[model samples]
Target: KPFVRRLRGDLLAHGVPRVWLDEAEIDIGDSLIAKIDEGMKLSRYIAVVLSKKSIDAPWVKKELDVAMNREITSGEVVVLPLLYEPCDLPEFLKGKMYADFSKPDEYEAMLAKLLRRLRIT
Candidate 1:
């Protein structure tokens, strides 16, 4: 998974501890809401990998809704999305700034700009 790889890369580069779920065999079905709730509560930053496949993914929607609700309620969580390819950012994340990883130089530039936009390094 590109997302899992990229996230692991970022965490390693930044020396941040992270928990990855893709490798796990745990099932998330009827308890998806509770799982997402826990993930939202545990993670400081939540990234929803948007794509043709992810557009209708229930989990993606849940993640987005959880992040948005958290932002509205607590104003502490951040959604930092890294676009792996060209795709609509959906209405939920439409207005908010997002990173475009379409090209190396361009993505790098956007990364710096986004850092400035988010007031982080």
Candidate 2:
């Protein structure tokens, strides 16, 4: 989750007014599903970090499902895929362009691209 924390920090530093990181947003007694659902609803875009481990996570799948549903219902792009490691992407994400963070040397460039997509700069 270090990557996520760093990403969140960078995003905030780059003028993203609000970022939804579960650890920061959700309290100890909070319901994970409900909080996540609420976060998805409130967010303009959902950034899905794809790594070998996260790809098979059940919670990640569920979150992706929610993000996909939001995209379908709104008829707009809401999911931003961030590839953190080399892994086979889900079928739905195959054709979508992602910000590649796999190569450490390319992080700043990829982050700039992502910010542009986010229309922050």
Candidate 3:
């Protein structure tokens, strides 16, 4: 959660217009599936923060499926994989170039690369 929070903060600080983080956007009585779907649809890019535990999460799988489907339908890249830990990536995301934040020292450089991709600067 800290990693995500930090990423969100940095993205916002760097002038990302909007960031749809589940914890920040979802309310107590909201429908999780609907909110996630809406977020995926509205986002220009979906950043999947990958880790050992997250790779096996059901919600992650569902989210990835939705993002991949959107990419197929829209005929554009919609998913950005952010490697936060050393782990084997999902087959679908294996070919995508990712911003690696696994090394603490590389955070700034990786973030810069990500911002470039997002055209934020």
lDDT of each: 0.65, 0.95, 0.94
lDDT of 2 at 41: 86
- All candidates: TM-score: 0.70, 0.97, 0.97
Count clashing residue pairs in model 2: 0
lDDT of 1 by residue, 16-76 (tens): 5554454342374637556557666787777666677786788788778778887878776
What residue runs in model 2 are displaced by over 4 Å at the alpha carbon? Answer: none
lDDT, candidate 1, at 79 = 79
Give the higher-lDDT candidate: 2 or 3. 2
Tens-place lDDT digits, model 2, residues 4-115: 9999999999999999999999999999889998998889999999999999999999999989988999899999999999999999999899999999999999999999
Per lDDT, the best of the predicted structures is: 2
| lDDT of residue 65 for candidate 3 | 91
For the record, the alpha-carbon RMSD of candidate 2 to the native fold, in angstroms, is 0.7
